[model samples]
Target chain A: MAAGNRRVDVEEVNGVTVAKFTDKKILDEGNIQLIGNQLFSLVDEDRRMKIVLDFSNVEYLSSAALGKLITMDKKVKSINGKLRFCSIRSDILEVFKITRLDKLFTIKENQEQALDGI
Target chain B: MRTLPSSKVMSSSDDLTEEFEVLIPSDTTAGHEVQERIIGHLQTRNYHERDVFGVRLALEEALVNAIKHGNGMDPAKQVRIYCRVDSIKIRIEIEDQGPGFQIEDVPDPTADENLERPCGRGIMLMRAFMSLIEYNATGNCVILEKGRTIEEAEANDD
Candidate 1:
C-alpha cells in the first residue's frame, strides 16, 4: 500500500523532464527530496532548457508541495532552464491561487502545451 | 451534550477509540499529498464539501508551517498530526519538533502591503478555514477546530 501511494514516474522528451505523481498525498519530505534530486540530476545531465511537471494525477496539493516547486523553479533558473507545470487538478489549482503562485510560474493546459510553452 | 476535555477528544462519535495520526516529513514538497488524503478521509465520512476544503486548507498550512518554519526543511524532523472527530466538531492538533515562535510574529497575509508575498499566508489561510486556531504553550502544538453547525458551536462554546 505504501509503495502504491509513492509511485512516481519520470520521462524525458526533447530535453524536457516530465514527472507524473501517482501518490494521493505529497505530504512527506522523502517524496519532495526525490522529486528535487530527480530534477537536478536531469538538469545536470542534459543541460535541459526546460522541466515540465504533469500534475493530472494529483488531486490535492499542499503548501509543502508548492514549496518544493518553488525550490525546483529556482534551481532550474540558476542553471538557465525553465520549470513549467501542466495538468493540474482544479482542487490543487485553488491552492496555487490562494498562495498567489499562479503568477510566479508558467502553467499550461496539458503536457503538450507545457513542453511547447518552452 | 457535555463538552469533553482536551485529553479525550475524538474525531467523531462513531469511532471513539480510533486514533488518527499522521507523520509529515520535514520537506515542504510532500505536503500536498498528505493534505489530500486527510481531506478525502474526512469527506468519505460525510463531511460537507465546504468543510472538506476548509480542513484541507487548514491542514496544508499547518503542515507547511511545520516543514518550512519549524523543521527548516531538515527532513530528519517530522511533523506529527493527531485528530479527533465528534458529531459536533472536528479537532486537529499538529506538533513540530522545532522551538516554538510567537504567533504575533507572523504577518497578516490579508493585509494590503503583504498580499504579494509568497510566504506568511499559511497562518492566515488556516484561520480562515477553521473556526478556532490556538497554539500550545510550547508553540510547537497547534490546535484547530471546525464545528459542524452553528448549534454545535454554541454547544461547545463552554
Candidate 2:
C-alpha cells in the first residue's frame, strides 16, 4: 500500500490543515486505525497544528471511531493545536450531542463556517 | 427466541421475513466485514442513507462493546450477532461470551464529571440511533431495533 493510501486527505487552506475523509463509513477497525495513523503522522511530520475535519461526506461513525476522534482531539490539543469539524450530518451530530461532546469541540454548519474566527 | 450454542449461524428468508446470524471471534478487525455485510444487505433493501448510517453505527458500537468490554479482547471468546429484518423493522441482537456487567451501573457519559471521558459513549450512541435498545438480563446481549416510520417512508418516496 502506498504511504498516502490514507483514510484522510490533508489540504492546507488559509493556514489550516483541512483533513477530509474519503470514506463515507468510518466503522470497523482498519479504517479507524488508518485514520488514527494518518492524523498522528500529520502531527508528527507535517506539523499541522490546526485542523478542520470535513465530515460532509461521512454519514456515521462507530464508537471506536468516536474514541479515535477523541484521542485525536486530545493529541492535537496536547501540541497546542486546534481541531474542528464541519458539514457534519444530523445522524452523526446526534451522537455528538448525546455524548455531550458538542460542548467540547467547535462544530460549524459548513466548511465556510468552520473557517470563520480561525 | 432463546440463546443457542456458540458458532451457530441460523438464517431464514421468506416472503415477509429476512434473518441472519453469525458468530465471530473477539478480533475487532472482523467487525468491518460484519458491518459491511449487514449494511450491504440493508442497502439492497432500499433503506435510507441516514437509517443505514444509524444501523451501522449502532451495530458497530454493540460489536465493539462485546469485543472489548464484554470479551475483554479475548480471541477465545466469541460475539454472536443475530439480525431480523422485515418490511417494517430491523432488530439486531449482539451477544458476547463473557461475564456481563450491570447496565445500570454504567456512569453517564454526559454527566459533568464524565464529559471528558472517552469510553461509555458507545452505549449512548446505541440508544440515540436505535429506536429500541435493550439488553438481556445478564447484560451480555444487546438487542437494537429500528422501525421504519410512515413519515420516513413517505419522505423517501418524495
- TM-score winner: 2
Residues B1-158, model 2: lDDT tens digits: 86645455554567557777888899877876787887777777777767887888888888889998899999889898888887778898999998888878988888888777777788888888789999989989999999864455466855
Tell me the spans in candidate 2 whose CA falls farther than 4 Å from its real position. A1-5, B1-13, B152-158
- Measured against the true structure, the TM-scores of the candidates, in listed sequence, are 0.65, 0.86
Give one digit per residue, the lDDT tens place, for model 1 in B1-158. 77755553335435632346667788655666666556656665677666777787788778777777888878789888787765457788888899988888877644556544446666766776689999988888899988764435445857
Task: Assess chain B of each prediction and give its TM-score.
Answer: 0.74, 0.86
TM-score of 1: 0.65
Model 2 per-residue lDDT at B24: 89
Per-residue lDDT for A13-114 in model 2, tens only?
999989898888787677788888887877877778888999988866776787788788888888999889999988888888888888888899998888
